[model samples]
Target chain A: MSINKLAYYPGCPSDGTAVDQDMSTKAVFEKLGVELVEVEDWNCCGAAEVEDPKVVYALNARNLAIAEKEDLDIVTPCSICYYNLERSNKALKADEALCTKLKGIDSSLDYGGKIKTKHVLDVFVNDIGMDEISSKLEKKVNVKVAPYYGCYIGRPPETAFDDPDNPVLMDKLIELIGGEIVPNFNYMKTVCCGGPLMMTRGDIAFDMARKILDVAKNAGADCISLACPLCGMMLDGKQADIEKALGITIGMPVVYITQLLGLALGIEPNKLGLNKNAVDTKEILGKVV
Target chain B: MPIKTWELDPNFKNEIMGEAGGERLASCFQCSTCTLGCPITEIVPSYNPRKIIQMSLLGMRKEVLSNPDLWVCLICQTCTARCPQDVRIADVLSAIRRIAEREEEAGNLKIDSPRPLFDKAFQHQLEKYGRLYDIGLAKEYYPKKEGSFIKGMKAMMKDYKDFGMRMFKKGKMGPKAMLAPKVKGRAVIKKIFKEMGEE
Candidate 1:
């Protein structure tokens, strides 16, 4: 089904660290003629760190309840939010007792678990369709793009829309924009970027990110295209840190899937917040523009 | 490194199964798939998911709950996705961590990692503003240790100085970003916390 509208859950980081992702996503959707209505009074989705299942359920159910009221499928760019929201929705639907407890929190907060929570990439690849997206591309991006899926978007298998082990939605989207897919990225594509532990375990996180960056760099890719803000933050925002810590030079530019899409669709670089990215995109942009 | 049979708490497995996301704890047959696919084990060889599960099943409640290695799993769910027995290895680890958190609260144990501290700060921001306030999170997270404010401030700056400067230069963090508005559902957030008995 082609969705013309969606209840957008921007999540917490979108306003600050991931502002570029938010802007680019909105610009891409607007260019595609899809209306994105913000989820009314949406709260945090109780990201992965929250171990208490009840708390995770309560926090996400509140947002799901609000989106349900909008009577539209919910969509978010952050994979962590997408995982928490979708997992909570599925759990709430299966467990009546948990749903009853959530209702006790607030009568209006009772989520029917009816709305489908989707990653923006899922919306772009499936709902929006590859043909429609390819038709909208105004510029042919002549660069080797390594598509990074990170972890959440296609893990735990049950909630994934694409193949959990070997996802190709982002690669398909990359192809749609006339970008070449870096060879041999399948093995490292879905490898964990160590995002959840980045703040607390910077050593391990940076090493894991370095592994992915090394794979991309060795594959001769011009840039990395991804969907999640956390991955972008780690791979792009912290690329310099990884280099300093590991004493290796990896100058891969990490661009969000939406930003790349927006670029190919003729959106201005400023509108896509291209300048906001930490790793310079001048090299890739020069080839495309 | 030796297992004392008498020290094992047989009901520890049951305790784990009682927790949410731990329903399938008993289903694990030690296929070692979780440990194989775990990215952390590759980096930190000492942090092994299979060993953790083996210890839990052997009834090493105190050892399992208080183990500092528990905090290093990253909760990436790679193990959960690959578990042959459908043990939901990641969720099982979360369940064990939840127990560990409770034990720490009761003064029975101590966690070495600053992850729990960060998690609390994250929750505090969620409860206060209905969304994360990055500046507020930093303020709450730092200066929360057993030290003077100056020490905590120094540590925070030392860790984030270079990264913060880069983010600032790129316009990702600044005064305007600092003043970003909070969600309007603070009341609802408070109620949710209260309902979940987390408040």
Candidate 2:
């Protein structure tokens, strides 16, 4: 199951907050001999907050429709995007009424529901294979990494490619790349990052993030590695705020899973956008570099 | 609180079941599994999923729809994943929220949270540019408060100063990123939104 090329959907945040993820994903994949072609003119997948099913289905169907034209399976790094796109793809295929309604939206845009939507993690682990990934690694990462698998990547079971309760693709990938997995990470791996409620309920969101960081730090993790941009926004972007609000000094560096993989592949730090992390990644990068 | 049979809308659960994500609403048997696994409920004890399901089942329409706890869900689907009844608790909540949004739009009830505002702004960005424009979203999401646009802007800046500064320093957010290119199929997106009646 070697994938040579994939249609990439760099969800909204990749263009902004998670730019590091966008950069490192491309860098690591290119090094692994996989080409990621951007899905042409893709739109937002209504990331979790959009409660209206009609709007959610319509938005995701548009992206799936565009990807169907590429004649390639779609892959996204963002967990929310992966879940929504796959959910929409499944619904659009299973529900004939949805397909008809979407057709009414744009007659020229027809999705035969032929394409499979995959998260990049699934592609790297299942399609590319850990053996191939390890062969490409120029450096074996030595830092202790807490592999954080936020919510969307493993929820609702039906759309998830990995185990919803205990996903090991990330752990396997990190281990293959020579990063040590934290012993206590399993408990907090699937916990919510409180991302969707960050805006409306910062108190709860911060507290939730605080717990994850505390667990990671307590387990002697050098850094936390994750997939979702929203999780990165909460864990990496808000680490400082959580510390200040809670009157605690976590100072835990959070890195995108791709960024860590990029480093292990000997891609330059700048190429991986390591410096873009709000929590300084220098300490962990120093150990690997 | 005493039971008020006269105020209950017996068809409320049926109404929820009619919604796209609510097809399984009637299957929940008060097992309390969804509430037990919920992370939000752990922090805010009052925001209970099982209770919401029970209320909807008993046809407590206004009480369920107008509840501010409705928006507190992270929609992480932990409960949905663990539900023995396959209730899809998160999606059911979302379905209820859709009704709440409509109710608020019709001026029948008021939602306390600004989450709906943010969602609208998010959808607006998608419909207008076919992708999210962070700055544009910020401008739309912050409350405009009558005529004090400058005051509102100041407040937002104050709230976001630290976070925005970090993003700006990393070259992730700023005027340059705001002017980043839009997708080529804006027209198609607008047409999709219009057709979906989301416009």
Candidate 3:
């Protein structure tokens, strides 16, 4: 397999709440022959809490500016980071004054918008191509996996890499891995997981996540596969809390898309950080072999 | 019964239009597609993205700006993606948030939720660490730095007593959360924040 490369921007949550995502992404990408070089001196995408648009642009621009020097398109596993960085890259490319203003923030940094920002799914589906990935799969995952795109990356026309209404990239990847797509999951595919509503309004966030879990459960999904860390944290990390709050049992294990792919590639469940998941992934893994 | 007057500040629309991604508000036609598409409205009845846009356009500045629901928008962009008129409902809500923040800072407006304070603490974390250090941000978030420090401190402790222990056991927070490492280019991050008037 020929080595492919990407400037990986493993967004904030990957450092802690979603370390399993970080580990699985690297392991799976490496297994697929894609080398993810951490964008040198990269910082946060500032998440959504930062309300100022200019500051959002500047924070993401700094990351892009660093990666442009590397001469490789930036890729992030986290959707919100992908959205924020891509949004900044587009904004700077269209407005010289904005780039100049961002540059003024740091005299040493340059913001020419020279590189592209890609979500990991884009690199997997479009760049690497499913045909290449399919050829490497050791075994097919036979269980039904619900593909959740969440709400961040696949939105706001210019920055969206796929259809905002019905994203099929994950579905394609799941198919490539020989995993059965949850047919009834089409309705809940792009719904908001209530990430931002978590701490501020726990009830609303929990209820929103509960609704998604209910949809997936009703679809008879064996597990849920997602890209964004926040969504993973919401569905996986908060599953118990949500269950307790809503007085409903949502036993579905939420796994990273990379982890699912890694599993299909015959990577050990432990190596894919399966144990790091809050909801037990053992049941789903038990069905695999 | 006497009719109640709506104190409409005509500048609200233009003020929101001044911000980035806010220019799309002109195209909104009250088609209610945004409302229909929003997942938040399904759960939280008070958070109507369409109504908020209508109110903002109507220049109901005081009503729109001070409402706690103003801070409730998830910025998920579902409404933005579905808006038939190309109205970026999420971005418009963000613009309203910015205006609300400025007003609150000036003491010209009052908000009922602690979200803004948490957002500010988050900003401070970004300014200091160039990334979100969850434990660091949480520490800054709960404790009252303003009026009624003792009461705020008690509330923060109560919260830690309530949810903090469980979060730590779940591996979401604790020594690991506190171990949120700083980004490599700390100086550059500080410079960007300072230059952007974030400091």
Candidate 4:
């Protein structure tokens, strides 16, 4: 049977600073005739902190239960959120002691271990397949884009769903939408996106963002795109800060991976979440289309 | 060396981590794997990952509460992948970071962390206008007389012409996109900082 509906989890960033990310993802998915069933009553997955022994797994545990109620696996676009939830779910399944601990916190929420989680990159690469995605390309984006695969998705390969060392979810999505991938700009593929910087330590967050942009710009990439909103928020939402801090013109069109596909599928920009970005993607796309 | 007794910032140890990572209680050991394998550390050695978890574990509340190092970890899995004890080294670092951000915002934590010349010059563009306008981030971050400013402007001008700025002016770069729904918590953010001693 053709898979028509996808259970989606838009992490905290999607609800806030990274809203455009979800919109763009859906806009393209909508055109592809794939419905996104957003996980109901979902809570924060506690990102990196859920793994601590003293910390109850209940926080990250809540999300998997929500996905299970619907009897469907979840698809997340944010790599950090995806990694956290996937990590928690994987751990819960492997360790009965962890499950016993979680049950003690919320006896009502049993760890039946029925949920499977994947980043949006996984759904795009595995479920949708490049052939179907390419068939929907109404327009071609000629920009030389460097695909930015942040750490959460690629480093472990468990969450990668694609090639870990040099994942091409970003590039495959671009090609599916008729964009040219710049083959050479690949050094910092598994690097951080500074999603951790928005809070008290923004200098380092912006520092990481500037480094990625430095490489992208030098490689002559017209744009940099990704699936993680936090990463996108760092690179796409914080472009000006990077320039102000570093005194470099690293103003490539930092966009969500799906936004590129949405454009090719004839989805409008407003629905794809481009309005809130720090970089002027409208300016760059203006050159391509 | 005997381990130091960590006196966690009550707000941070109890409220921040509890709210953030649910009080990640002293679970990390300093293997230097996070620092050793961290890609950011390779690029910038000052970006330490192991020291961060140690500070959080020791509950050196003030130090971790005001740390600029807190926000630098990319959540890149370098530390998460290497921890032999199953300590979520990266996430714990980030949870502490989120708490520090609140501290900085509330004005309780007065810290000075230098950004690179480029990021210092233009990060405000994203925070304010929500899009990167090269012309704008540059003006806001740098003074025109600075040699770096002149050099950056020249680069944009050169690239613009090379990429067909004249045609670009006609509006045809790529797909048009939109922003997503704003997360519901304008006051919560303010309150978190205020609770931490921000005005």
Candidate 5:
């Protein structure tokens, strides 16, 4: 595990609504003695739209430019943010024309597209090393957890951090960092969370998450560990609406992956950014801690 | 939250995302496992990881592609992998993109998309070198990057920082991409794409 630092890309969620998530990410990171540098003037991860490849690239390029300028590997907390940043970085790196255009827009920026972007969980597992995190485990969240990686980061390892179909980083991180991951948890291996919030037509998105939760419930997972903010917002935010809408209850709380790390590191739940979560982790932690 | 509304086909709402992947779409159960699993969905609100599949199932092809979800996906396949029901979220989006591109090129559809140009540019790169080269692609993508001082400065600085910048090119990886494999029948691969209606 590298002891020095983590170049952080808080992205959209980390600043406000996901502040809790951000806090915990910092706590765990600090506990590991890693210096965290926020990506300066980082723009959105092209989250709102993909209309202009030019604009989209510019947006993602802005973040990459910061990462390159600072000469630090980026560690984003949100899955979607991580995915887009890394994906765009990968794409821009490949299409020199795209990178050039992006560089053109930012005349003063050095947008070389060589910086490697990773999810916070990735830094924990890869850079921090689960073994170190495991060594620091003062307490274990015996809570049965279904580690949810979401889509963007894992698969297309070329673009993101790890393998999509069978991701072991989070699984390993959870265990080493002092938590339990349900190995055979049924829905642990699935796709998007009713993507883009079929919220209006939520019947589509709702049903998808509902099924996975059911699988977790069936598998006895008291909670699910997450890497993406949208994943948390949707799963945690909409859990009640989904439960009422679907006439079922998962009772399974959704918590940020970093929060778990913080807890393991003896960082209190509240200070570790547990508050930002839509679904409370209290009961789950109560049972585990 | 500036909402940019467009004049989508009047028939858009009446149709559903194609049924090919609808049942799986219906199973979304919204664990957001897909959304959580989806890396792109985290950054961009414009692209809905789950909605396109639903739109596809609803046969809302026009709506789905035109939604920006098609282009924003990054084709990471995370949505499909995270989907419990095994919904081909990315595949459905890919098909929608294919249809949208065909429609735009044929002028049957008018989309507020720079993606067509992006796609065309990508195609041109593929055709020229049978692979996408970053240096060449950059010159092709942004003309300003060619002779500007900022471009020169950035390029030199980037090269200085990351030594591998020169070798950074799309589709230049994996043994197969570097050299189009010698198939037992190269004609077969050609025929498949041709029959599949790909160039």
Candidate 6:
């Protein structure tokens, strides 16, 4: 069954930092019969912390303006992009004077506030619905996954895509794929991964990243499954760095939730960009039936 | 140890309240919930969110503006989510950082840290190319930052050796895409930044 096409906002990471996320997102969505229509000529979301809120507002507003012109709900695999897009839209709505000034900044573009920003996790849980997703799984992925939601998907009560305190969206998705969630760990829901800030403060970042890894490892998780690419970058890309910094070998591989889902859907592992992960996933894959 | 009397600037709280996103300053009731919920506080015990709010309300202007902890927040909104008073501690801290930037510019405050320089470099890169180029950022940021050419180059090469080689092999960075790939609507983004006086 074919679902309606979404205006996919393949944020900056899609091109650079987290290409595997982009590939798996596309592959899994295609298999699920949902077509992703890339927003034409999209700009960077300016993930770095800016001095002025207006700069971030304007940056995200441009992307929203582009999608509004296309008339489709925007979907993104990156949590920061989803958060910024949603924050910008809300900022515009709150202050009319600021919104008017922003509109006048660029005469060529229009910030109509027409589109709704949805995280890919939300699209899977709410839009695609679990029934359809479960029926499509070709094989049972019996791996134990520590579902790391991070802090972005749900927080700031006003603009959350899921429950802020206890988000079960990823847990449900994990079970549907025949993966077991690490039982009864409240800290698994909303831990900070020290993203973006990791660039300058590797010490703090490694410490924070280590805490998440320690929890998952203690819970006997075979791997960590996450939604945000920034989390993926920290957990997967910096997994080795964290090990070196902490002087402990955490052999668990960090895989994007979509990649794991694609695996359960029986899509070829290479097609999901499983090879690109910094932590080798081959040993784990060998164990999975 | 000598006892110290903090000359309370009652106007400091009012001044912060006057800034954008800082209007909720009066709502905080000295509940330490924000500090308890903060992840940074767990590692860096001296950096306390609830204490920072108390100090800000009590008019600790010089201390609040100059402290490096002001910039350490990830702005993850964890504190904001848990704050019963809707104090928006993250926004308040961000506002303090903005004041710090202004003071640093006027030479009233001197910061010995990498964050401000790095932030300026990130913003400048966006202004020039409408996106972050790591190579460009390193070129533009490191010299003045390290206060010497040799140290800057050494630092940059060390960073490249650590993660750059891996990122390059992963295709996250390359000569073609990282150097000069096609940027769509560069003029429009530049104009947006320019009009905002961010240029």
Q: Which ten residues in a row have the lowest lDDT in candidate 4 chain A?
A: A48-57
iRMSD for every model: 1.5, 1.6, 2.3, 10.0, 17.7, 2.0
Correct interface contacts retained, every candidate? 0.76, 0.73, 0.61, 0.17, 0.09, 0.45
User: Per-residue lDDT tens digits of candidate 3, residues A1-289?
Assistant: 3338888998887767888898899999889888889987688897888877777888888888788888888989998898899888888889898778767668545777789999989888888887898888997787799999988657977788888989899999888888899888887889989889776777788888988999999999999999999998889888877777778888998999999999888898887888888888888887665
DockQ of each: 0.73, 0.69, 0.58, 0.11, 0.06, 0.56
Q: Per-residue lDDT tens digits of candidate 2, residues A118-143? A: 99899999889988888888997889
Best by DockQ: 1
Alpha carbon lDDT at B30, candidate 4: 76
**CAPRI tier of model 3:** medium
Clashing pairs in 1: B9-B59
Q: Which ten residues in a row have the lowest lDDT in candidate 5 chain B?
A: B163-172
Candidate 2 per-residue lDDT, tens place, B1-199, comes to 8968678999999999988789899999999988898899889999999999999999999999989999899998999999998999998998899889989999999988878887887788878888878777777777532125677587678667888888889867756566845878788778877777543
Model 6 spans > 4 angstroms off: A1-3, B1-8, B174-177, B197-199
Poorest stretch of ten by lDDT in candidate 3 chain A: A101-110
**Residue-level lDDT tens digits of model 4 in A62-168:** 66776787878888888877777776777778878767755655543455688788777778767888888777777767777888888877655445465555777
Q: For model 6 chain A, give the 10-residue run with minimal summed lDDT.
A: A44-53
Any residue pairs clashing in model 3, and if so which? none
Reference-based lDDT, residue A281, model 3: 87
Please identify model 1 stretches exceeding 4 Å from their true place.
B197-199
Residue-level error in angstroms, candidate 2, position A110? 0.8
Q: Which stretches of candidate 3 lie over 4 Å from their true place?
A: A1-3, B1-7, B145-176, B197-199
lDDT by residue (tens digit), candidate 6, B1-199: 4313367677888887876668798799988988888888888788888887887888878888878787778787889988999998887887777777878999999875677788888777776776666677887777767788788888777655656666667766656447743457777778777776432
User: Which scores better on TM-score, 2 or 3?
Assistant: 2
Off by over 4 Å in 2: B144-148, B174-176
Candidate that beats the other on TM-score, 3 or 5, i.e. the better one: 3
Q: Write the per-residue lDDT of candidate 3 for residues B81-143, one digit (tens) a residue.
A: 888888888888888888888888999988787788888888888878878888777677767
In model 2, what is the error at residue B3, expressed in angstroms? 1.3
lDDT: which is higher, 1 or 5?
Answer: 1
